[model samples]
Target: MAGDAEGFTDFATSCSGRLFRTAWLLTGDWHLAEDLVQETLGKVYRAWTKRSRPDDPAAYARTTLVRTFVSHRRRRGSAERPTDSVPDTPGGETDVALRVTLLGALGRLDAKDRAVLVLRYWEDRSVEETAAELGLSAGAVRSRSFRALDRLRAVLGTDADDPTRSGVAR
Candidate 1:
């Protein structure tokens, strides 16, 4: 009993940073990211008590995180659709600046597409795992991946299908 408690405590502590990072990438707001990560941990804690034979708690937590983000996005609807703050080009920014630009570009994409891209590129999940995680068909994952990359390219001021660009666009 004490061992399980300590194990979960350690798990939560170690996972919190990563979970928060993922949440921030998904939501793009610091406060919301904090809230979402807290909520995800709360959910994971609840599951830890009842869910047995849990293969990967982090994976389960990630799925819950994505679902929570999608729900919040749906609730916002049109309000989130307009973010005039993003710039059109990379300009004279440094690498961190370029990352910010890319993240803002990701913000313009559909929520599902954003999730697919984040899960694939950021989290580095394979297509099959992503499909299973998102409850999508393998082909559907491919399509979403394709379209999301295109939108990301357009947002980054690059041609979506230009082979000379990083494979992220082509």
Candidate 2:
């Protein structure tokens, strides 16, 4: 039990920056990223006091962050209207090619699909871990993952058979 406090300290110190960056990427807003990180850490802190392993704190945290972001989107999505116009870019100077491509592809995904893809690719979690985190069966995770990847490829205009984008090697 005493180790839990030390675990909290270590986990917070080690993973905070990465978590913040991920949150920023996920939310696309720096202020919201701070809120997400703070809220996620609070949930982590509560879980840490009762959790079984210090080494697995990050696993718990990542799951919580995904869950939190999904819940946030659901709560806020109801008030949002559909957009018909293409989004305006502020500067034509900087080449935002990769960012535009990735964000465009990601925008086409449902919240759950986005979470699944992000966890699978960005966080580099295995199918089993992703399934466990999302409370899904392994088969469901596998099916959804390929479907999500296919959608990403279609949006990115990449051949589905391409090895690099196939996500098998990388």
Candidate 3:
């Protein structure tokens, strides 16, 4: 019992930051990302306590986070509340602007598309791994990756050359 607790603690300590980043990409809101990570940890912990630890706990956690984000977005109350003004954050002005631009562009994507982009590009997962994680086939993952990149390029108004010139601060 004690060993399981210690192992879980170690796992959480090692994996939480990456999981948090994934959550942030999924939700496009820091607060919601925090909530998603906590929910994922709880679910994983429960499964761990039951001695049903997955062969790859990190992958399991990622899968759980993505699924949870999708389910939450489907809720009626998940409609984002509009705010009149942007909240300020302590950062270099250009950095903040770039992050906001990127997140806004990501938010425009459907949940699955966003997930595929994050898993493939951000997390650097292979097509087969991403397909398994998202319950998709490799062909589907490849197709979605192609379509999602195109949509993101369109949303950001980037052409084939110098794609980063989307008015998003480097």
Runs in model 1 lying further than 4 Å from the true structure: 1-3, 51-53, 80-94, 159-170
Q: Write the per-residue lDDT of candidate 3 for residues 1-170, one digit (tens) a residue.
A: 42399999999999999999898867677788899999999988987787556888899999888888877767736566423233355566555655566567778888888898888877778999999888899999999998887787787774422443333212
Clashing pairs in 1: none
Q: CA RMSD for every model?
A: 4.4, 5.0, 3.8
lDDT of 1 by residue, 1-170 (tens): 32376677888898898888788777677778899988888787777776472568888888888888888888885644635353333356445555666678888888899889888887778999888778899999999998788778777775433531443332
**lDDT, candidate 2, 129-167, per-residue tens:** 999888889899889988887777776675434633634
Which window of 10 residues has the lowest lDDT sum in candidate 3? 161-170
lDDT (CA) for every model shown? 0.76, 0.71, 0.77
The lDDT leader among the candidates is: 3
The estimated TM-scores of all candidates read 0.81, 0.73, 0.81
Q: Pairing residues by index, what is the TM-score of model 2?
A: 0.73
TM-score of 3: 0.81
Off by over 4 Å in 2: 2-7, 50-55, 81-96, 157-169
| Model 2 weakest lDDT span, ten residues long | 81-90
Residue pairs of candidate 2 with colliding backbone atoms:
none
- Tell how far residue 99 is off in model 1, in angstroms: 0.6
Clashing pairs in 3: none
* Model 2 CA lDDT for position 37: 85
